[model samples]
Target: MRKALLALAITGVALLGTATPALAHNVLISSDPADSASLATGPAKVTLTFDQYVQDADVNQIAVTGPDGNQWAEGPVTVENNVISAPLRPLGPAGKYTVGYRILSADGHPVSGEIPFTLTKAGTGTPAKVDAAKASGAPAADASATSSPSGSTGIPIWVWIAGAVVLLAIGLTVALRTGREPSQEKTKQ
Candidate 1:
């Protein structure tokens, strides 16, 4: 009886834990070249990593713009697993370059942030002379679909409470059933 009570309590706790939403897209896990990295040379590419796998086609995008406000990204964004990368078009003038990205989360919302990297000396390739306005396309940078088939999970709170109550009643019945055994034993004695 005691063991059954303990088992039911453990099950209840586990179910309660599942009631809360999972951390699908809350924190920035990591980035390639790291945030605030001071590199003596300009990187050929920029990559951003997330806590979960991000899709390439739909929501993931990266845009690299120089301090001069000129967009220097070489081509379309590439996504391999959780990492997303964009090419650099001859980085120019030593300064901070902002890597702006937006990735679609597994849960269906868009997540976006900027990573700053400084170039100490100078880059071999001169900055692309493209106008900030001409580089017109603001890459969406969405990485993944935040809401999945499971994201549609919906259950009333009262239903959960009622289920818990039903389980508790069953557990109590098992615990009290032992009292009947003792009464039978007393009569036999």
Candidate 2:
């Protein structure tokens, strides 16, 4: 019984040690236009800042939607450490504009949310040519899906958890077997 308990305790400590670092996802710290901001002129670029480094992945996406329900984000998105930015083609028909983003978090998860701001005045800027798929407000691929530098699928958190569980089971089995032998000998004598 004591050996079994010790095995469980060791397994618990190992699991906690390995799981702590991957538990936190990136949090949005700030933005260029700010959430719920009211602006007279549109920002040339939209920037989102996070509490941790943003993973530089092609799956990272940012979309600026105007009040007219059109995409305003122009050019490719850029990720620099903890900040993600995208150019805008200017905003038109002032009202509310939402900046939606799906970024790969530093911890390998995908963090997605929107920042809404009101455009107090309209500017003479046309929306970007919308792609049929992107217009639907869904990412091209699962942002959470990550690949390693060697082009291999990264090990997911679930796998690690499963491994830990398996290890615990094995340890418990070994401990219970060894614990039973001492009891069996005592009973035989």
TM-score of each: 0.58, 0.78
Residue 93 of model 1 has an lDDT of: 77
Error of 1 at 4 (Å): 20
Q: What C-alpha root-mean-square deviation, in Å, does candidate 2 show against the real structure?
A: 5.1
**lDDT of candidate model 1 versus the reference:** 0.64
Candidate 2 residue-wise lDDT, 1-189, digit = tens: 787788778878877877776777789999989999999999999999999999898867887888887788877789999999988887999899888888888877678788889999989998777673364343422223432333322357677788788877877887777667566788999
**Top candidate by lDDT:** 2
Tens digits of per-residue lDDT for model 1 on 1-189? 566667667667756665443335535688766899998877788777777676555445677767776666766678777777877766777888777776655554456777788878766675554554235344522213232334332343566577767766766666566435566778998
Reference-based lDDT, residue 40, model 1: 86
TM-score of 2: 0.78
Local accuracy by lDDT, each model: 0.64, 0.78
